[model samples]
Target: MAGKQASVLVQYIAVRGDLAEKWPMGAIIAQACHAATAVMHVFKDDPNTVQYLSDLDRMHKIILKVPNEGELNALVSVLESNNKDFKLWVEQPENYPTCLATKPYIKTEIQDYFKKFKLLK
Candidate 1:
């Protein structure tokens, strides 16, 4: 038991930084939240999601920021090419892409894809 590595599942949520110019803080946050919740619901049956949820207090999520919708869409394309499962949340009425969230994944398996993005402040 002493040598076993710790559990390190993570969910990455990237919100758009450019949205602040046209949207209020509350709406921007709601987009990220919606994306996060949507991914969880979409991938609820995934093994990692099951394990990640097993420990509610220890569940990990990395919130990062994208400069605008373009970067967000580009990231989505990359994820699609890699066959990674994720949810890209688009705001209704405006049809705006605001954020994206990858379902729970083993940290090391997907962390690199997000290195270019900074922590969402």
Candidate 2:
């Protein structure tokens, strides 16, 4: 995977694990938003890319509350852009729903957030 993509994945797993430790929903959402904003900065040259990443991050919060097809599809689109055959990573039954719902959003958020710090660019 690309450096950005790998970073996103690792950060997401860490966040998910942290959230699983009984963190409040609001806190989780805030963290996610921050991460998304950072991720958006990585693609500062393209506003649409930033918007898509932001939206995906927002949708990820929603997905945590309610899993849906559209959100999953959006995530798949983002992942595919970073790594072809990314779906293979999601194929494991244990990882299916959670990864499908959260990975893209977390990645987008992290990128956007870091970008704000001018670290990504």
Q: Of the candidates shown, which would achieve the greatest lDDT relative to the real structure?
A: 1
> Residue-pair clashes per candidate, as listed?
0, 14
- Candidate with maximal TM-score: 1
Name the regions of candidate 1 deviating beyond 4 angstroms: 1-7
lDDT of 1 at 54: 95
28-85 per-residue lDDT for model 2 (tens digits): 4554455445444544455444444554543322323213334445555754665522
Model 1 lDDT per residue over 1-121, tens place: 4323234788999999888557888887888889999999999999999988999998788989898989999999999999999999988888988899999987777988899999876
For candidate 2, the 10 contiguous residues with the lowest summed lDDT are 112-121
In model 2, what is the error at residue 115, expressed in angstroms? 27
Scored by Cα lDDT, where does model 2 land? 0.38
The C-alpha lDDT values of all candidates are 0.88, 0.38
Q: Each model's TM-score, in the order given?
A: 0.91, 0.31
